[model samples]
Target: MEEEDEQEEMYEVQEILVDPKQKAVRIDKFVTDKLPRVSRNRVQNGIRSGSILVDGQPVKPNHKLSPGELISIVIPRHGDRPDGIVPQDIPLDIRYEDEAILIVHKPPGMVVHPGVGNPDGTLVNALAHYLSDTDIPVLPGNDNDRVGLVHRIDKDTSGLLVIAKTESAMSFLARQFFDHSIDRTYQAIVWGAPEPPDGTIERNIGRHPRFRQKYTVFDEDEGKVAITHYRTLSDMYYVSLCELKLETGRTHQIRVHMGSLGHPVFSDEKYGGDRIVKGTVYSKFKTFVERCFALCPRQALHAKSIGFIHPVSREYVHFDSELPEDMQSCLDRWHHYVDHRRANNQLEP
Candidate 1:
């Protein structure tokens, strides 16, 4: 029942020692409580598959654990889970590649992996086609076709991604992400300039109670701790360009955190960035802002860079990407607008 990395091996083993003061408990329940994000059904399935063992002997789900005993569990990882997915020959913007790993520049409008609504035409499908002849390991606990992905970015956010070609590479890269050793930076254009210009936004993020698809910040201990360090790069009066560094990779952390500060990313429809949140209500200014929106219909955000230790080389690797055309065009317009207004003011004097 625990959610594990999809790129992990088929057989993962864990050993635990029971305490003398502990009472007898069902093996399934014991495991479910022990593993974070694991479910009861998964533990039962593992037991049924004879993957659960006590003292080197397979046990049933109803079996109870005793004190002062050794418990070992062999989780059967999901095998060839992407068999149902058909690979398509989609082109990729590869940045760096070697025997063990490859860094790809993912374009906007491409889904990272297959899911309920998106079953095909994903980045995974393209990777499958690109590596059709290679032997990529099937990761445990992953139900979908995310072959070698260690992490993911939003569909609308274009960025660089590192993919593992071997199991050792996968494990090493995943560990780096879990330890927060990977350095990731993003560039975004927001509605208005933040008051302090540069600061850290530390808040807890959880699923919205009413909207299942959206996320929100929590004041209590309900959500996971999320931290983002941001600094202003350009201040254009109405809107500002900022760089953000993440300490944790929670879902929608950057978007939700910035939205809570009343400076949502430009054109982010999910967090109400489509509407004008700053600037005058005059028809001329509104129209100008509309033109800026038209230049970049999606959120004005991009994964600019990422750095991590090379899994096989034991050396540090860093990759950076330029802003996409849409975002660059949007910023150019903002700069032009600011310069034009300054010229008008000088002429009036």
Candidate 2:
């Protein structure tokens, strides 16, 4: 039998100092309150495994905090964390490349990094292979598997992506993303035209309680704030093409926000855009819609453009990509459908 490759485990250490005015709180509660996404149970497990320390000594979950004490926690890198990423001979659409940065036009169905289920053949793997001859430094204090990524789009959403070739460049671009200075615009075909045509969507987004794989809008106190500004570009009656600008980037922010507005991206299966949301019940219309879906098998969303300050040159740079063939063909089909209907006076007033 062939020897199986064991998944590599990585650990990250975080340290915190006890405040002078801090009360005697349990270590588990203190760590949970400090870490936003971490749960108390996980912290307790780490404590049980001797992964948590106080002033260089292992501590229990119920250990009481004292003023002027140092606390340290060793966290396992898992859950969307990349293991050992093997270099693969995957093709990449290089839009722009320089010594410190590279802009890639990511195609639909390409994962940005390695994660559960998708362990290979990702953009990162391809980048690793392409950069094997060069000295692409691993990001400091990050998973080595993701050496170049500053930001990412969804797997099935095609568009422009900027990659950092150096640690300084990565830090500079990551800061831009944190400050919301990086300009990113996406083009999407949605099921219905948004009311008023142009507007901003401000909602909190978090993982759904029932559907672990899906995200949903939540109360302000429950989830992180997400904002998206959008305007309709073309109205095809049942569907509308729109341009969306993200003010804040959250997981599934665009998809969840648009779904909340009743205009999910066309053919987004996870968010209920696969079924006809705005069309007649007739069998012919259903068949036509199915054909349109077949034309663009994935969600009709594309990262059309991105702009940011160059980390090394300190000059502003922008890049744009034409719509992928799949999405373009789908839009052309819709345009032809609309035009033919209008010519025959079949469109509703």
Candidate 3:
């Protein structure tokens, strides 16, 4: 699910008012002093970006701040910060937590970390706040924004993610992912039933040439090797529910592979699943499909389960989550349509 997607710039403007009894000080110094994590260089960078404004006008980094003046600091919500991650009070659906690890259910449309268009309001920001009071050490070699994170899913792919609370734990869990020793299963609603009910897709995946934000399958000599094993759980003919397991975790591996097999994951706009791929061309069918799209506005894929070896206990641990409401609602609609068609002896050929 972690694919290179287009990003839109977003800014978080923070306004500060000079204290009544404050002395005239350089703006950069004032900013670094006023903000907890803001550094002098970051303030200067913000000034250069015209993000630091005094009285609604951009000022030089050495501009003197006077009492009662309103200073606005506009910082990109993304990972452009030089200081560290910003902690926000965002709620998290924590599934499991211990000394060495944490598991959480990420909802659809929530970015895993701060980047590009999503600089703030991410799962990492939430983790920053959640662990603010704890003594959990940040992962070695990782940015503070991605402190405990070892893996990431797409913004729209709802699922469970494992987080490492300590450096040793981080290395331990990361090794499992690198070795493909981690067990992961995803449930996706894809267009049409695959030819072989159960099969494996082995292909090389790389970023598209023209569309840098998107990915495409490539020759063996080209991109990275990716493997996905899928089995049909239910076949409604026009669309089927599938369970996919990964042998290698590549960006957009499941989506790209399913798309290569002519079974794009339902509602995956980037992979052509947002249209009527397998259903009839009738107006009624179109309406039904459109309704389903509205129900699940994002890709109909869920990371159902994950299994890994505990870093502390060395015991195997597994976690599972139910399908989110949007996906479940979309599937229910498809089930109802299929049942109605079967009852009328008009099921699609």
Candidate 4:
């Protein structure tokens, strides 16, 4: 959810007219180059779905733009179809709620909002259903897809999220997040112990040029600034549990930063933690790692805690969450493995 491109929380309608002297280009490429977060694939999908049109008519993705032609598009808040966010019966772990806001403990694997591959069963859909009688007018500037959401975590990262139920609440909470005053802490099982136990990582992060789905560190001139402060909670030899605090939120900031430090989050297939990055090559060790991966098929990361100012009450509020079963069970196995190896004097020097 910290990905730069994934920051938008409102459905948007954009209209652009080609200049009289503009050169002809494929609509997909033209739209992609013109928009900030829009991808070529998303543009093509929009064209196919008839959400994108030129000169008041639907066109192919490869349709060439002509001078004075008008281009119009509707970008979904996340990936939901502009018209597809319907109230559903999806369950939510509501932690706290009031007239001004709602605090939710989002579980792993549940998307915060609907998108292309995901049409429903999202937190937004559930909120729509839960607040059906509240008459909450869609958080001011945002469309119904966003509802009360001010920020979000990844679909695979379980954690706390604050939702603003009113215009004043949304403005207040959004400002806090933009100012980096909303404190958030995450626990991640990462490969190897970090050098010096704890420190801060300052780098720029941006989407990979070749792999659009992945993010990588970039130079100051290219990407946005990202900072993560981390401390090792437990060193299990082969892997360590780390607590990370973010100063600036960029897309995949923690994943990219930790991977750059040579200790990717454990079992994070996208960042190369799915393989054995450290520890012995013994068959037993390999088997143990494979089992651990089975215990937690996704990245071993959790949004452990969050603290922020309450918009209406003007008081500081903090929320904490326990690790989910998959992550906890995986850690338990690692703990047992480490203890047994140490007792048997089998650990490498």
| TM-scores vs. true structure, each candidate | 0.77, 0.76, 0.76, 0.77
- Global lDDT of each candidate: 0.77, 0.79, 0.81, 0.80
- For model 3, residues 1-349, the per-residue Cα lDDT tens digits are 5422111122334789889998989998988887756556656766754556799786888898899999876543333346678878999999999988889999999999887888799998888888876776644323455667767789999999998776556545654665478899999999999999899999999889999978899999998888899999999888999999988777899999999999999999999999989867889999999999999999999998999988788889999999999999999999999999989988765
Predicted candidate 1 versus true structure: per-residue lDDT over 1-349, tens digit per residue: 0111222332345788888988889988998898755567757755654445678676788898899778766543333554555768899899988888889998888988777798789998888777775564433323446567767787888888888775556655665665578898999999888979999999998789999988889986788788889999998877899999988777788888899999999999998889988877789888988998888888888999999988667889899999999999999998888888877872111
Worst 10 residues of 3 by lDDT: 3-12
Q: Note the residue pairs that clash in candidate 2.
A: none
lDDT of 4 by residue, 41-90 (tens): 65676676555779878788889899999997664443334564588878
Q: How many angstroms is residue 151 displaced in model 1 relative to the true structure, after the best TM-score fit?
A: 0.5
Residue 204 of model 2, lDDT score: 93
Candidate 2: misplaced stretches above 4 Å?
1-83, 135-143
Q: In model 4, what are the clashing residue pairs, if there are any?
A: 2-250, 2-251, 3-251, 4-251, 79-115, 80-114, 80-115
TM-score of 2: 0.76
Model 4 alpha-carbon miss at residue 35, Å: 18
Q: For candidate 2, lDDT tens digit of each residue in 1-349? A: 0000011123334789999999999999998898866667657766654456789776778999999999876554333444456777799899999888889999999988777798778898898778775675543313356657767788899999888776556545654665578889999999878998999999998889999988899988988788899999999988999999988778877888899999999999999899999877889879999999999998999999999988777889999989999999999998998889889988753
- Specify the highest-lDDT model's number: 3
After superposition, candidate 3 runs with Cα above 4 Å error: 2-81, 135-143
